[model samples]
Target chain A: MSEPDGGTVGKAMTVLDQVANFGRPVRFSELLKDSDFPKATLFRLVQTLTQQRLLTYDNQAQTYLPGLRLVQLAHAAWAQSSLATVAAPYLDELAHKFGEAVHLAQLENGQVLFIDKRQSVYRFDTLAQTGQVAPAYCTGVGKAILAFMAPMERDHALRQQAFVGYTPTTHGAPDSLLQELDAIRASGVAYDREEHERGIISIAAPIMSDDTNVLGAVSIATSTSRHTIESLDRFEAVLRSTAAQIGSAARVWRAPMPANPSYGNSGGENS
Target chain B: MSEPDGGTVGKAMTVLDQVANFGRPVRFSELLKDSDFPKATLFRLVQTLTQQRLLTYDNQAQTYLPGLRLVQLAHAAWAQSSLATVAAPYLDELAHKFGEAVHLAQLENGQVLFIDKRQSVYRFDTLAQTGQVAPAYCTGVGKAILAFMAPMERDHALRQQAFVGYTPTTHGAPDSLLQELDAIRASGVAYDREEHERGIISIAAPIMSDDTNVLGAVSIATSTSRHTIESLDRFEAVLRSTAAQIGSAARVWRAPMPANPSYGNSGGENS
Candidate 1:
């Protein structure tokens, strides 16, 4: 995940991410073992990052985790990002109405990053945790976003997918996934029928700006024991509407766009 | 706010923060006006930051904002910080029971940075937004944490306060605030009597680990129109218990230790 860009700043960030990727606080030696950077460089980077309060070091455990500074910055990011703050009330309403788990996800680094989640009142352990990442080839939210992308961007995003089969229903090749994407474009919906996980299923729709920009995706998830895939069909209209609401809201509430529009842009470039 | 430490890395972060402080997408010229760095230096910093994904540039608006990477890092921080994740269930219960806004906060750079918030069903525009920063001398969560800190640490923290009164009841000096802190330590809670905002009042309690370490604070905030200061007292027992539960949970699920403990150590150093 560490791409050597932006010189010293890039290196420092790589070290910072390594620690964060662990989720649990990590010791220096543990980081050293996993990092591609040399020991001296890694140590210096860690030291500087700690001094900057970008990485907090715990004395007792002798490990490092993300610092409070990151948390503070993230607050700003959430406000700017369309998926979390902009869609908060809508997600709340969706969860309240359906009485099932609801999730909002955005494409980050060509992978499906679950930005926010609302746990169902009747909880069963579902693998989709907030900030958890998954393959774009199998999951409902992932397919929803992939379906609406411009062909070139869609192909680029598709190439990045691992295409690992998680279950019998999972897409294992690019051609099969492309076929599904074509179908999703026509239907304006994507479904996961035990594709990502056994007994878990969800119906998803892509959130798009008025100009057809792929903002993100929203999904209503439940276990098969509680609800079948057909039962999830009842939520299609609601999911699409919720996604549209978020997309329009995102259009009004714009965030800073990237300098390189070819990679990730607000508007659908190919369209 | 920029101390100019860590050379290039520090300057880069300072530039990043100035953009974030705007709380909206900001142009390069606008950033230049507020930044301590020279124009060329500032430009370079922004470019490097954008490349690193620490800051995002909007090609359409030609502005900058916090990037998705920060959001990614923040997800890790939220889980690791313990205040938010460890206290999630408690916060949900508190908000559900009182049907009032619940805030969880931690001290950062002498300011109170809200880590998480549970909005009551009834929505009203109270000043506190999640991940928002507020003056430590005036807010309930701020004072609650301050009151429990060691005397020496308290004085250091107090020195950092601007003490600019936002309302008539806001603490104007260290002596008066110290008196309130003493009262809080004795009563096991702190109150904001429309101190930070004209109509906002909250009852808060410090979350502590063992006998001394002040982890953070939790508050039940409501508009004065909803309830009087005396009426807020009814929440004292519940707030204290909630704070205790979070503190205990935090102790069990600790994050990593710092390399240098003196600056921001875990222990209540004075004790």
Candidate 2:
């Protein structure tokens, strides 16, 4: 992973990441063991973060966890910037219509970041949750967005892909993934075919602002026990419609803002 | 709100809060107009935040929104640290049982910060969403937790409250709220009675560790059209039971960790 180079703020954020990645109340010692910074510097950073309410210090546990402030800020992030808020009603509609899980995602730093999800009431265990991230080359949503991205942007995204074979059907190289992208462009949809995880399959469609600018992707995911890859084709029409609706809603939402010359018209990449 | 006081990290976080509070794609000029920091300092902070991916710069719109990294970190925060994850299944059960919206929240910096929510299929317009914050003096979950808090902590929390009359039922002073807290302590439940919102009412129970340390609060909320304040009594039994179960689950989840002297045994207030 590339380390942030924004000085003190960056260092503090990295420390925050270390605590969060542990996914449990982590000790300063445990963080120090894995961190690049020296003990004193790390200690001060953690202290500062705790003071800022970005890292909560568990008194009884003597460990650190990501703070409640993140939850507050994240709420704002989801409501304000994410396609999740715009896509919510549509996701609910799609999920209720099909009785299948629906996921809405956008590319963040060349990976697919799930911004929202609606689990089928029938299915209790869902692979994706809001805020989960997955490889851009393997997942249906990832591939759908990739297929719709501009060539220069697509190549940049592809270069970042590790191409790890997560399953037998997973793409193993850029060439293989690129081939699938071509097929997706033709079909206007992408299929996971259990590429990212065993028994999980999804049909995904890109949510685009126009012909070239990809906003995000939406997918209806299910287990192999429920549907075969060919059988998943039944959801194509509704899924595409939902994607288009979200895309249009998103476009209208952004239409009020004037375009900036510094960054082109495409919403291809955001930093 | 008190600004963070941890130097550069604090400044960056303040800038982040400014961006997030806008709840839209905000321009630097708009941020500068409302900011306490001078233009150069604010500009540097925003640039640093964008680089660190704590803030995303929209290329086309030439605006900033809280970054996707926050969503990722907040996911980890929610799963690992927030009571929301532990309380999710119980919230689901409560929501399903009553066919009403259930909210899980914790006290953060003297405010009620909703960490998770389960919206009833029967009710779509929920008053609280995960990550939303409200005054601890007015809301059901807020009052429930505050009633069970230690005097010192409760006083501190009370001081932070503005006592704004969101509705006529909202407590106008600490003395009035304290009297109600006493009643809540005796009843082992708190009722909103449309205090925070005119048409909405809720029954709440505090999730406590032992008899002293309050973990958080859970509430089942609905419109007054559906149930009167007296009618909400039917949900009290289940609500209390759910709170107990969550408290137990939370205790078990924290049992293995040793206490630190820097803070104390209580999980009452966290940074």
Number of the top-ranking candidate, with DockQ as the measure? 2
| Tens-digit per-residue lDDT, A1-271, candidate 1 | 3455647888888888888889887889999999887999888888888878898876656668789888788777767775688898999999999989999998876888888899888888688766677888899999999999877888889989888888999888999889998999999999998888999999999999755569789999999999999999999898889889998888767633444354444653210
lDDT of 2 at A107: 94
Looking at model 2, the pairs that clash are: none
Candidate 2 at B116: error in angstroms? 1.4
State TM-scores per candidate.
Answer: 0.90, 0.94
lDDT of 1 at B134: 89
DockQ of each: 0.47, 0.65
Candidate 1 wrong stretches, greater than 4 Å: A1-3, A254-271, B255-271
For model 1, name the residue pairs that clash.
A57-B257, A57-B258, A58-B256, A58-B257, A58-B258, A59-B257, A59-B258, A257-B57, A257-B58
Worst 10 residues of 1 chain A by lDDT: A262-271
